[model samples]
Target: MTATVTEQVFRLPDLGEGLTEAEILQWRVNVGDFVTVDQVVVEVETAKAAVDVPIPMAGKVVRLYGEPGTSVAVGAPLIAVAVPDERYREEERAGSGNVLVGYGTGGGGGRSRRRARVRQRQDEQPAASGPGKAASSSKSDPLLGPVSALEGGVSGAVVPSVSTSRLAGTPQAGEAAKPAETAGGKASGPGRKTAAKRMGEVPRVISPLVRRLAEEHGVDLTLVTPTGPRGVVLRRDVEAAIAASRNAETAQPEVAPAAAAPSHESAEAERVPLVGVRRAIAEKLSRSRREIPDATTWVDVDATALVELKESINRACPDARIGMLALLARICVVGLRRFPELNAYVDVERQEIVRLPHINLGFAAQTDRGLVVPVVHDAHRLTLAELAARLRELTADARDGKLTPQQLTGGTFTLNNYGVFGVDGSTPIINHPEAAMLGVGRIADRPWGYEGEVRLRKVTQLSFTFDHRVCDGGVAGGFLRFVADCVERPEVLITHL
Candidate 1:
């Protein structure tokens, strides 16, 4: 019996709050592989979490868009699945309810379109859709797709510190476009516009920076054309256009010398692609600096009492030893109760300060995978002992890269214990969307005035950064003072708890 044939395009879905796209970490299924409903097809890394995506229906994988390590937008086509015609039609009628935020039930089937597979070179297998056939005939592994040219020998002379450069016309580390090859196994070169012309339309070009570069260089994108993977215009493509223009300008010799200054500087720099977690952190931290009007206030506190309290607790209950961070976090929860405004967020869109009822406290933890803040939810409800246990657990999880999206977000307040790093003080930038962050510096023995005499006491510097829009300095001072009081006299926290 001839089965009815239908194509289903699966697009990348929103993996977490505020996530625009995700890096394709790995693909569990290959083209021509038969996958059943709810079978995990790919694992993606979002900004705050790593998520596994499962296909919503049964089908045979036909094509995979983009390669592993490439970032795919939320609504971009991920994979195409071919199913029995009757099943696909039924699925269209009775669409699955497993929809993602910012996406609809139909999954944008109206935009479901596919491009012709790139022609491969000799020694590569022919493209086939089902099991027994290869996905591409390129030198690259058919399943992994073609490796970006940037990975071959491009060192990103544009950015040195990180792997990828963000400069115009430079390939991001590991994510440069895979150039199409000619019949003789040579790059088709920039002038070739076969991929764009074959689509019978202007290719859907993304990348705001590419457009901006084109504008700055006075080059029309359509006129320049595309040679990047899937006919997308890349930074290098725009740069090439500008270079071509400059070569043309030599004949005229009338252009300003100022235009050449930037090129000289660019030649000296190394470029790296801001990808993966590094890219996310850069974007979030930049947003925090731009949006949050923050103010920092610091004080030196005698942490002798707090330190003694911790020792006593650890001695009495060795099983659940409370660390300094746990104690400070406990003190922070108490301080927030007295200064609730500091625990709130500014809703600029609504022009209001939101007072959160629960305190999901996030503590800064430095891990191998950059800096992360693993949160303890409903921290106000947890006992001091429970708080210590959960803090340790989350800290370990963060280091192990096992934290979930929920564990990393929804924090009403943050505790940054840079003290572990042996630093004295830091003017903390407020974690955006949250009103305040408490920074704890290293505890050291310093001469202090105690009982009308100078004596050696354990002292630490505490810096508190608050969103100025949430409250004035008066509230900020009050919160910091309350926390200092708890550190000076651990007995005070006992009364509040």
Candidate 2:
């Protein structure tokens, strides 16, 4: 079964919490492209949304799996990154306890650092800002943001703050210098090569599985030469070393074949793969229908006064942008406070209703990617302006595909303004694990009976869906009526405000 990599070389991220896979949406960084640590390598879509995935190493990408729209499972190898240099791979593997050379933090006190005295001429000293610190030529490495290193220079000196040292081996005072050290940190002279050979260092192995195989077979890695790109030890090399040790003379070195292609049976249909957030959504919705006895209740309300109040407030404070959604959010916050039972989930195993003390209000916002719910933490604590501002920020981030995982989950109750779609009402499914979801339909002009006569009024439909196991229509109806009254008479929110 092992074609190359011996099996499971490098794998995709483990999306814990029962999620087993992600579908590749697109590649942000291509093969042969150099990437820094934490650089976004790909944009992967889970059922929840499209999330930008970052690679955790500084290297040139050697390999990546599949084209866009490919579905990969957890623990599957997504890409193989060939690290930049031997020292980088070693330092990264051995852990940063022994600080790796050639890396500099930024400059200090507006002053550059003193360069290391490694093989530099006596008169070629750099200019010093004060008495102690010498000037440095520095540029930040993408691997570490704001992490400026000495240009062409590798330092062993401990300096304070960021490094603003001159480039390694760069002649500061216009003098000809010896051949600079190679990217492998090897000096030019024969004597330096001898010294490097004497030094003890760990062998460069990217895959943990490779190291494990070598250890299991009793093969010494230092004795085996590397064959992978950029001096990385591949699994085949280790296997070759093992064969040589066992047979000694009769065994020949074997090169591993490429990973086997999928059999014709693996070819799937045109249907969408059920995984990540999408699979999770399906399971949750299905479970909600199966486990929780749910019901929907609707009401029509006269929102003419709420609209008039919104206009008056907008005119009064032109600087503050308080939207209708924010007003509704505030109303929901108060309504939930009045009827707190709706702000809870079912503890299935314990057979109990878990009422949350704080509220994380999730509101639906549609973007080019798809519809998403961005949650507002502690919605009970935000003012109308604050709520509107947060909503604007989250919605903007959603549109730009920059929402964090935390912002997408942990919603206590949902506020769905389906009204934007030009619809009247919907039997909105409750966000699972959430006890309820409040849906607001389009508010339009309609004939209504006022105090003494028929008049044109702004009317909208409100639909409240809840878990019947948590409460009957009594509590659900009460919460709906409270929100409706608040919408009709905006002044009534003063007591809660």
Candidate 3:
């Protein structure tokens, strides 16, 4: 027998949340290029992040179904591959490399053990019925014969067509039997014309919501066996599959029971479809919340000096658009240095507090979708100008939804500038795993004691929430005081550096 070349198509992997589709950013390997397993084959941009998609199997790329910049649906063919090895085809038929099916190969390559067959009533047809009888039966009975053909065959050839004139002549039946063109022009077969007219009328098995959820979770709905009415894939079925995946992951060793609940929405929502960045953000935030204990404290500060300092800096660097928020972030880094305990996270599973030497500050920005905390790595080392430039770049990218996973991870502490919203002050939730969060309020003219004299001054409130389990009130209070002092004496921040 001639060696068969099994065509393999790689679909987009789950980018988290129901991010059903992605814009192909670039094709790393063009048609005919040989690629190895796990090689970066394409770059795709979802709403949440730009991700590099890897090749699942080593093969020669035969064709690309979609071009760069085009949005392709999840599970749609991305690239076709042809493996030269004959053994690869045999292995595939024997179910090797069927990772998508949840059965992965274990090093030694032999034919996969066959599964025990489950007897089905349909598989055992009436012994009295032969192929000829079945074919004749299918031709005569419009419902029984043709319907069997429609179910068994990929092509709809088994459907029979009736004359549209006969259908149209009967006001109701004619309306039902609309004109439908077949490959042969003439519509023949029972319900052929009706089926064609109703093809658009047929209720699709997958709903828009189901599709959206599947896309977010990077789930191949085709692989998800449906449990809905009429074999339609339901949203709940997809969610259950996701939950089962999480449960399996949690069962792994050395992980806390609480941490086992991999980040996802409550299984109770009417429609919780994992999609895009939202799904990823949910998982990370969930993990943080479960793994950390947080505490918060507030301090009112006179920001008159910092406001003046910003004006002075703006004058010195004409091109730099320095803002109070960036100045506040700089002070936070200086404060975190003095109180290093606040610049660490509690690894509950390991029962250890990780004290990071570098200060990677995460700034919370409000996006149209939700809150995203994009980080500035090594914030302590950067000068004011460098910090301002990096902050500007991060904020711009966060708003435009261009942030990568790297830019969002590894934050030792976070600052939520609620001040921009013109609010006086409110306690901000801790961006968990990190022990604390600082909320900055808007500066407004208020009466304050300066050198024992009550006078009008530009004042702002700062709410610092820390993980009390890790650090008590004294440590948390001291950290807040240090940050407030830095903001009050803007020059002190420069001295601390």
Identify the candidate with maximal lDDT.
1
lDDT of 1 by residue, 1-497 (tens): 55655567788876657777776667888765787766788888777667778777676676666445456677777777767767766665766655444433343342322222321211122222322343432344333334322222111111113222222222333442334344454445543345434434233333444555667668767666666554456666777877777666554444587764443312323234455577778887898999998999999999999999999999999999799989999999999999999889888898998999999999998887788888899999999899999999998888877676668878999999998999999998777789999999999999999999999999999999999899999999999999999999988999998
Tens-place lDDT digits, model 2, residues 7-79: 1123566543344556666678754467665567778766666666665555545445544544566656565
TM-score of each: 0.66, 0.58, 0.57
What would the per-residue lDDT of candidate 3 be over residues 412-454, giving only the tens digit for each residue? Answer: 8999999889998886667767889999999999999999999
Ten residues in sequence with the least summed lDDT for candidate 1: 151-160
Q: lDDT of each prediction vs. the true structure?
A: 0.71, 0.65, 0.64
TM-score of 1: 0.66
* Model 2 residue-pair collision total: 16
How far in Å is the alpha carbon of 126 misplaced in model 1? 7.0
Q: Which model, 1 or 2, shows the larger lDDT?
A: 1
- CA lDDT, candidate 3, residue 294: 66
lDDT of 1 at 80: 74
User: Where in model 3 is the C-alpha error above 4 Å?
Assistant: 1-47, 50-78, 81-275, 278-290
